[model samples]
Target: MKYDFDEVIDRHNTFSMKWDCREIHVILGITPRFDEDTIPIHTADMDFRCCEPIQRALRAVTDHNIYGYTGVFPGGYGQTYYDAVIGWFKRRHDWDIKAEEIVYANGTMEAIRSCIEAFTEPGDGIMITRPVYTPFTGTILKTRREVVNSPLVDREGNGFYEVDYEDFEAKAALPSTKMFLLCSPQNPTGRIFTDEELLKMAEICRRHDVLIVADEIHGDLIRRGNVFHPIAKVAGPEGIITCTALNKTFNIAGLQATNIVIQDPALLDTYRKNANFVLPNPFTAAATVAAYNEGEEWLEQLIDYLDDNIDFVIDFFREHMPKVKIRRPEGTYILWMDFRDYGLTGDEIRERIYEKANVMLESGPQFDPERGEGFERMCVPTRRSLLKEALERIAAQFPEG
Candidate 1:
């Protein structure tokens, strides 16, 4: 069955965090005065519907109508769930994973917090790349750990970013730095680290005794012709805790199911002890089983549509708003845009985009307090027509001189 990627779904009254939540914007320092006509392209989740198989799985669960306590323990659903996860990774990424290595979590952030508690002490430094996902910083700080930032250097002065290896080694070597929170196929910037890069970073952490927590939720969302290597695959599984989830890939984040892969027994035991006991949601279990086993066709088609949407934005910006620098992302549906050429403060840019243009965008400073000025992260997973309209509205706000 062919899916319609062009269909525009109305998400206004569905309690969507991206659409209905105006107070969240105000809390995040964005203007909250958008009317009903406003378009939001900030949140990372897609506006697309889940695949037919996943929908069918959820309906089956609903039909059962038994919402009792459930789990993926041993018999019954356990083997099926594990087999789906293992098969998906083996087939898609060529990385073989064992059933024993998989641990369940409510969400990726929750898993990260548990890792922090289980591994590091309070006041220990957790390293991250700036102009990164804001939640990484928030999670580290909220866990009472110091945030050691190794800012990604855009050496070309274009939007492309490279790891400053020398700086990374220096931070890892710090006695206070106990862990490295890595974002593979990194967020916002969208650069998938090469094997050599991954190995170098992993080696540094191993030598410095820094625990490595790799967030690989975006592993399967690579743009065409690009590949994403699981850091655990590149840098051996020891001392590495890999976070994987079908939520991002299958557009089922609200279901809140995440798989934390720990190949080392010691690390796995420690994580389990510290991590909250996440009782499996029946709907999430059904969704994951179907998604991993049968949703590949839909995923491939979705990627093609997403790829076109990305190119459309790149072309639209180049033609209409040339000063707004953007490059095609190698992975993820996010586009990290540089707005420094306009010479406006981040707040001014946000005001114009939110108030005048009435299009909601994630402001740069939310990702990085210092270097993220005059930048914005746009999530481009909506219908192409709506995306074009949003871009045109934004272009009207910032006229080309």
Candidate 2:
């Protein structure tokens, strides 16, 4: 591999939220549990270094050192910023989008918040399937909307979770339910919604007049055999709003850049009016163009590395920790593991992992209180050796029964 994903760069004292945030234990309601030596396999941020091309682009900005107020969209020779996303969707997803349809935002959550504020009234219902990404709920409540859960069905004996269409339709049928926030290549479970599943979901949301906010932020990180069906593709272009970014894929999240694509001019207008959020930093804008254009090779290589990591995780657990079950994620670097066999509550599991293993993982309850119980989300976007060591620590503490 041209990129050395195994290389570990020390992030301690770097002000990295994932690594340096002692306050996380406070947020998680645990005593501050870890030191600088703790392996934070908790947050979604990649432990590996970012694509070189993106770093180089940011470096050029630092070299200039002007640091003045910058325009929102790249202009002049930099019009490639627009062309970058346009060409990306076309080349990668086979989903063609126009320049006018694209809107820039700092992050996916910001875009979702804006969409919620724009389309839904306070106290209106927003439907989500769980267990899901943590921020999905945070953004909903932040905007004063009600969270309507259409929890997914946990298939018996198998680790895979499936969408509960009946519950979904019932939830959407609620008159107050205004929108559905869809996470493609879903975060913790890593299930890529099949075309059939997406069609069913789209039909229900459309029939009930619920707007669709598709967060395809993890779309590019799909495993080899899986296909990512964008909600817009199934739901059509009308009321669907697709949010995507290179932050997760290219590990440039600190840049705070994301792309929002909405085909409906009236809806876009409403969203822009409500969101009125800050524009991307000049470095982010510059690096985004570089990521969408030149970062493809790096992304492909990264996916290959992640694929191996996934395989290693599955094998390691099967061999050493058979009590823990994993479905083998279809997408995302985040691997959801079920520790229910140990009969421990989510908090118990989390506390054990922290105190005994000294590895920080996102507890399932943090995703959804009920569905997330007995589950833990482990991020595998780090060096394989480090991941193995973390797993060894965990396995040593939670040995197979």
Candidate of highest TM-score = 1
Worst 10 residues of 1 by lDDT: 26-35
Tell me the tens digit of each residue's lDDT in model 2 across 1-401.
29899996898888898888898766765435878778888888998887888888989999998777665554576567889988988898888888778888878898888889878899999999988998899889988999999988876957677888888999999999999999998888899988889888888888999998999999999999888877786667877899998889889788877999998787878877777856667898888888888888899999999999999998998888888889988999989898999887767777778877899887888888876788888999999999999999988887554
Clashes of 1: 0
lDDT for 141 (candidate 1)? 90
Q: What are the runs in model 2 whose C-alpha is more than 4 Å off?
A: 74-78
Q: Give the TM-score of candidate 2.
A: 0.96
Model 2: weakest 10-residue lDDT segment is: 70-79
Q: Candidate 1, residues 308-362: lDDT per residue as tens digits? A: 9999999998888888899789999999999999999888888889888899888
Residue 316 displacement (Å), model 2: 0.7
User: What local lDDT does model 1 show for residue 92?
Assistant: 94
* Residue 222 error, candidate 2, Å: 0.6
**Cα deviation in Å at residue 305, candidate 2?**
0.7
